[model samples]
Target: MKVKEVTFSYNQTVEQLKAVSLAVEEGKITTIIGPNGCGKSTLLELMSGHYTPKKGQILLDGKAIQQHSPKELAKRLAVVHQKNDVPFDINVERLVAYGRMPYKRFLHSPSEEDEKWIDWALSITNLQTKRKKKVEELSGGERQRVWIAMALAQKTPILFLDEPTTYLDLYYQFELLELIKKLNREYNMTIVMVLHDMNQAVRYSDWMIVMKNGQVIARGVPEDVITGERIEEIYGVKAIVDYREDSGVYVVPIGPCQRDE
Candidate 1:
């Protein structure tokens, strides 16, 4: 997906994004990182058809994003939002079945092809054991996995994840990141996500886009774009940069604290 000089604003006052231009490459993980309310979510929304750009275009597979119908868009891009209002009694399989809505007709049930895709999605998420369970009874991490399963069921080449690990324990957070990496490596998925943890972003992202005040300050591979200087510049916090020799990724903001006088 390529965003050609897109500009978006909310309420016509705050320039949420200022002429931002970006390209989300295929078969790679691209992460957007910034402080609170810095338009990371808005940028995703714009790409997902929630908001239209004032002066530019978002291109997917050489076609403009806005040109696709909503159903067409659903088949092309799958999204896992930060929060969702799920029905308490819905079984996992039924819920994932909803991801195939883009392909359904009136009074239609799951086709053989849809069932195959759903089964594959459950296997990928390792949620086949919980496929018959109700979503409300599951843990937070489990529910997030269910959400991802639904996205996978969509069977799109592009996936958009908005803070998929929010409010999770350390173990679950690490697990989800690993799962995402596995999906990308094995499936050739084009993944785009927003993450608050800079260190985690560096670990998971193949390419990183650092945004502040609604503009991109840096964009490149993790090692090239994520730096102590860039973190302090974008996030206004003192940080220590640690380079892992094994992985060659720089870990930043050892602590989110300021120097004492």
Candidate 2:
């Protein structure tokens, strides 16, 4: 997917994104990270066709994103938003079955093919055992996985996640990131996500896009794009990157930068 010269405004007054452009490398995990209110989630929404850009265009499969109908786009890609709400109480299996809606006609029952995808989604997400349990009965991490299972059942090549680690404890955070990595490595899924944790972004991402003030400041591989100088500039923090053979790279933030008054 490619976003070219895109600009967006929520109310036609202040712009959230300004002439931003970037190409997502296929079959790789691309992460967008920045401080709060930097248009990270907004940009993801636009790319996933949730919002329209006031200027420029988003292209998926070499065609304008808007050119594809909603069901058509859903078949090509899936989105797991920052927040999800199921109006009524439901079990995990039933919830995941919703991902098949794109392929099912109204009032139609699940075909044999739908059952296969649904079962695969549950198995991949490790929710098969919990399939019969109520969504409310699961832990936060399990609930997050349930949502992911729903997305997986869509069986799309591209998956977009917006701040998926938010509201989770540290353990669940890494667990989810690892699952995302597995998806990219094993399934060759083209994954795009908005992340707030710098170190996690570096660890899990194949490419990085750093945004600030509604514009992309830097985008490249983690080694090339994430640096002490750039960290200070983008996040107003003084930090160093520690590299180890066992653990890979980590960003250590010592303190906030001292700005001239």
Candidate 3:
């Protein structure tokens, strides 16, 4: 997907994204990282067609995103937002089956092929055993996986996640990230996500877009864009950007800096 000079605002007076433009590399994991309210999630929403740009265009496969019908867009891209509201008594399997809605005709049940995809999504998310459990009964991380499973069941070429690791403990955060990486590597899915953890972003992303004040300050390979100076500039923190032969590049923030108000 490609965004060209896009601008967006929530309330007409306050712009959220300002003339931002970037291309999501096909078949690779591209992450958007920046400080709070820097338009990372807003950008993802714009690309996924949840929000229309006020001044630019988002293209999928060279066609304007707005040109596609809702069902057609659902078939091409799946999105997992930061939070999901699950209905009471909905089991994991049933919830995931909802992803097949785009493929179903009105009043028709899931076909055998739809069942196959649902099962595969459950297995990959390690939610097969919990298939019968109510989504509300699961822990935070498990619920997150259930949502991911639903997205996976959609069987789209591109997946967009917004702060997917939010509210999870360290262990589950890493676990979910690993599962996402597996999807990208094994399925060749084009993945775009917003992440706040700089280290995790650098560790997993093939490409990074760093934004500040609603505009992209830098976009490139993680190794080249994630540096102490850039971190200080974007996040207003002192950080150490280190590279080890075995572990690659990582960031360690020391402390916050005083910023002019």
lDDT of 3 by residue, 1-261 (tens): 899999999987999999998998889999999989999999998898989999999999999999999999999999999979998889999999999998999998789999999999999999989999999999999999999999999989999999999999999999999999999999999999999998899888999999999999999999999988998899889999999988899888999988889
Candidate 1 backbone collisions, by pair: none
The number of clashing residue pairs in each candidate reads 0, 0, 0
**Model 2 stretches astray by more than 4 angstroms:** none
Cα lDDT of model 2 by residue, 149-246, tens digit: 99999999999999999999999999999999999999999999999998899999999999999999999999888899999999999998878888
Write model 1 residue lDDT over 1-261, tens digit each, in one string.
898888888777778988999999889999999999888999999988878998789888788888899999999999999999889789999999899899888898779989999999898888999999999988888889899999998889989999999989999999898989998999999899999988789889999998988888789998888777887778777777777677666554555556567
Using TM-score as the measure, name the better of candidate 1 and candidate 2: 2
Q: In model 2, what are the clashing residue pairs, if there are any? A: none
Runs off by more than 4 Å, candidate 3: 259-261
Could you give the C-alpha RMSD of every candidate to the true structure, in order shown? 1.9, 0.9, 1.0
For all predicted structures, in order, the TM-scores are: 0.95, 0.98, 0.98
In terms of lDDT, model 3 sits at 0.94
Each model's lDDT: 0.89, 0.93, 0.94
